[model samples]
Target: MPFKTEEMLLNVGPQHPSTHGVLHLEVTTDGELVTNAEPTIGYLHRCFEKYAETLTYQQIIPYTDRLDYLSSMNNNFGFVVAVEKLMGISVCERAERIRVIMAELNRIASHLMFIGSFSNDLGAMTPFLWCFRDREEILKIFEEVSGARLLYNYYRIGGLAADLTPGIEDRIHSFLNQFEAHMLELDDLFTRNAIVIARLKGVGMIPRETAIAYGLSGPMLRASGVDWDCRRDEPYSIYPSLRFEVPVGGEKLGALGDCYARYLVRRAEIDQSVSLVRQCLTDIPPGDVKEQVKRNVRPPVGEVYVRTENPRGEIGFYLRSDGSTKPSRVKVRAPSFCNMSVFNRISKDILVADMIAILGSVDIVLGEIDR
Candidate 1:
């Protein structure tokens, strides 16, 4: 029996908890099936690129922190790496080790947030609390090091703001010792749950071609069976020396491009980050990790783009300097912005409920998207 159903316009965003941030989804649906969905952005726009034009190279570091607040340390890492490359300068090995430590720890913290919030979006509340419980430990580490929790203005042009505090290594090691155990508990409770598998598996499939065509990076691309990580492929800082596994969509883990694949890739990444942090903690050489270089950092009159692996995706900074205290051009290639592009295409003809699951898997942070 055929039933008469008319297309209707629905708005899921700008205020909805699941849209992730100040994002609006203009969705057209027929009954419970969606025909089209598009994203409306800029509600959280802060004019970061335009504002960077007036601020010095060093002054813009804090602004990058705002782009992806959950991965503030990695945001700082990407920007400074770009600035350092632009200026043709390098920091000491100790600073590099410390930088890697902070970035990887931030990676772990950010991924934990993803697991929690993404699980919460799927109606699993226990994983949310458990993930955040461990994330708090990372926040405490950041606070003791950078004096700020959310938006850390720590990384400088050629070095860091300061050295690791005494016994912080012990603190991180202690946290890691238990975080692994908690992850196992989560694995038993949520990862292998029949409900979670039913909700995520084989839905929101982004084939390898579609993923590459949309310029997807990080876990989004890897989840679609593409094994490319900017940290490994485009070696920068101390990543070339770190040994870690890059998880892709595999038979044993997740089928290609599905939401479950995305989840598995990120879950595996957390363990790799744990290995990285442990590596750095054990071998941080002694050095003067001060706010190296003066406030006025003038690079040569040239342009360079530096890309680093962020929790969401690849974060690239395209910087143009005029041999002055400030940059003439600063453009950011935010990963969430690119990852969000393919949402509507994959959304067509799917149930409205599945659309929500797809969006959650995208894991966008509107701060970066709007910028």
Candidate 2:
């Protein structure tokens, strides 16, 4: 006689460690294999869009910081750029370079967190520590520049809140010199480990078409061999002049668009970001960091949509101005929110253990998803 089988419905979390945040996954499984996965969000929703409409343009900067707390500087960059476009304000060259440097540094820090947490989710603890150890250096630099370690409301409508502090570039260069060697060490320790390879390789594959259909962005979209990056294609702020490679998942490591592929893409992006930072340091010009603008920013009656390449993906802000101090409408195109839409599609027919690997690879920030 054939063995009897039964399907079980499993609730992964509103509090589970593997879910990454306050996200609930209603996963249906047959023994160890997951047959279906439905991600239930909104536990952390703060009505971010509604709040933006009520606050003045400057006031909303701090709230954007809360959306993707890991990449707060990028969030600030996207919002300010949008408001600047609406107001027709021109940012100084020096401020543009400063914003790019800060945003890229935040990208590196955010990816480092992903690396650490993803490794922890896969059952290895050592890489997690190593990732955080390196990430701390970046965070310290942020603190020095912004005076806040986490939610930095450092970007203004026309430019930055302040210029880069003296000697900060030297500190950044020193960190970059050390970070490259440490990255190689991390690769040897975890990226090539047999256990990690077995868990990640050929698992949770998302095809290029599916990724595009779902509007996935950032590393998730690139890892699927899409070869699209808003920074490169869209050309926002100083990104037009910067030179860096957009890493994509190819057949070299366990087929394209797999969990392992995403991991490799993120690791490679860290290197590219390091290179971008060096270019910013070498070419950064001296000029007025902030443009002269009215204290109460009242953009002329119009609407504008601006997108920036954030650490997670493309962060866009749509603003409708009615010649008021406050925006008439504010809508944020959050990358985490869009990326999470593909979870149910990709998680189908994978092992429950593999589901964890897939979720880690997706790297959703619940704050942004639930917003």
Candidate 3:
């Protein structure tokens, strides 16, 4: 039968569990295959940027924590780096080391959710629970350091809110020793599993050139064989001093771009992050975690763009400041937003079942996308 004249428009979510946190997708489909998809955002918008412009530098860290609540440490780093640049203040040595450790730990936690949820999308239940088990250990580290698990307002403008408690390093070291085995086991279970490879290897393929053209950064870009990592390329916050490889897509079926490639890139990144954490612990200089600053922090009127290699991609914050106690404008170039832009392009040719899997592989958070 020939196709109908009018395509059916279906809404995937404002409330769908698969949409991942209040993201609404206006998906136009010709039966089982999506023809066009438009992401409808702002359903969970806290207006963090608008609020950021109104609040002082010190006050904005908590709001940043809400942008992508999964990896609040990255959000904290993004805002504070921008403010620190504006104020011309550098964080202390120990603060930078602890910040790196916490941020990378959070990255692993976010990736754990990605692996688990991606597996669940494909009807695999075991990997989901197995992944979360390890993630819980990472959460314990966060709670010990920040006194909060999810939205940790731990990283302040010029330093950490506080120093790590005694023996936290020992706990982290033990976790690292065990988490490595867990990650390897999980990888063996799913990364090389026949069913997952069949579903993902050739589906939702994104080319390297197109990924760059679309402004895709982070794992999504790297999965397409683009060797760009913000931590290595544009080093900030002691990352330049760290040793970690950028895991770009490798030769799989002589092609470097697909959902499978993205998964591989992220999986490789977990190992890299773990190694980085160990190095940070060894190299962290003894110093004050908190830097002294005046009561009212007024940076000279200017602007700065700071980017971090979040688990999602290049999470960026652009801040404009006037010589006031607060910012004039704050904009987030959220990776999830850019990563989601490819949905309409890629999902049009795939099976409906693959749509959820593909979307999950992109690892989006509606909070960051809409914000």
Candidate 4:
């Protein structure tokens, strides 16, 4: 006679600590194994797209900041670039380099948060504190440049709101030097820890085909052995001039598409971002940060779609203009939203603990998902 067990339903909260931010996971379990996992969102919905339609193109930048609150600079970059494309305006050379520097710094900062939070979810508390320590340094730089730490409305339609604040470049160079050493310490502390390796390796494996079908991007897609990166594949702004390798995951640290692979990809990206920032610093030309963009900020009656490589993944903006100062329609292709959709599929048949590992690996920010 076979052993009999009953399935159980568990709600992992729109309030659970590990759900990250106001996300609820309706999980079905058979003993310790998860039978299915369904993500329930909308707890933090601010209707950013709707707000964008009502506000001026310049005003919509702050709304984007809330979408991926961790990667506000990249969010600002994507929206401004889309509007600039629609208006046929080119930002000055210095502005382009500054944008790249800020975006890459934000990328490192965002990944640091992921490193901390993901490790904490796995029950290692040390990494969480260490990662935050490094992240705070990046936030300080942001605060100095933009006058706000979290929601930086720094990027304008044609250029940045202002050039890098005085002594900001020196501060950035100093931070980078310190951050590089800390990254190595992080690798030793968590990446190679035997227990962490065992927990992450061979868990929550999403095949390359499945990942692509689900529209996974960033480290999630790359962890499944995909070589596509928006920064390299779809060159924009000053990215084409910069030198950096896009990290792809495949048998480097365990099986392809496992939680470990995803973690490794993000780990590698921090190094790449550092390199990009260094390049931007060395090659940044001097010119007026703000271009001769029209004050009214009205675009021709047309639509434009722009995508950029955010820390989470590809953040896309679709803007439709009706010859008005405000966007007629604004639709955001948030990476966290697309990445989260694949959770239920990958979480099926995994252990409850493994489900957490998978969730952490995906790195979904509820702000972007519910926006």
The candidate that wins on lDDT is 1
Q: Score residue 23 of candidate 1 by CA lDDT.
A: 94
lDDT of 3 by residue, 1-371 (tens): 99567678888888887888898888888778777778877798778887787788888888878778889998888877878887889988899999999999999999999999888888899999999999999888899888998999998877889899999998999999999988788878998899999888888888878898888889899999888888888888899888898888967422587888888888888999999999988845789987578756888989988888788988888888888998898899998989888777777766778888888889888888877
Among these predictions, the greatest TM-score belongs to 1
**Residue pairs with backbone atoms closer than 3 Å in model 3 (clashes):** none
The superposed Cα distance between candidate 2 and the true structure at residue 125, in angstroms, equals 0.5
Question: Would you give me the overall lDDT of model 2?
Answer: 0.90
The residue ranges of model 4 lying beyond 4 angstroms of the native Cα positions read 1-4
What lDDT does each candidate get?
0.91, 0.90, 0.86, 0.90
Assess the local accuracy of residue 192 in candidate 3 as a C-alpha lDDT between 0 and 100: 84
Ranked by TM-score, top first: 1, 4, 2, 3
TM-score of each: 0.98, 0.97, 0.96, 0.98
In the predicted model 4, the residue pairs found to clash are none
Cα displacement (angstroms), candidate 2, residue 100, comes to 0.5
* Candidate 4, backbone clash total: 0
Candidate 3 runs further than 4 Å off:
1-7, 252-254
lDDT of 2 by residue, 66-132 (tens): 9999999999999998998888777888898888889889999999999999999999999999999
TM-score of 3: 0.96
lDDT, model 4: 0.90
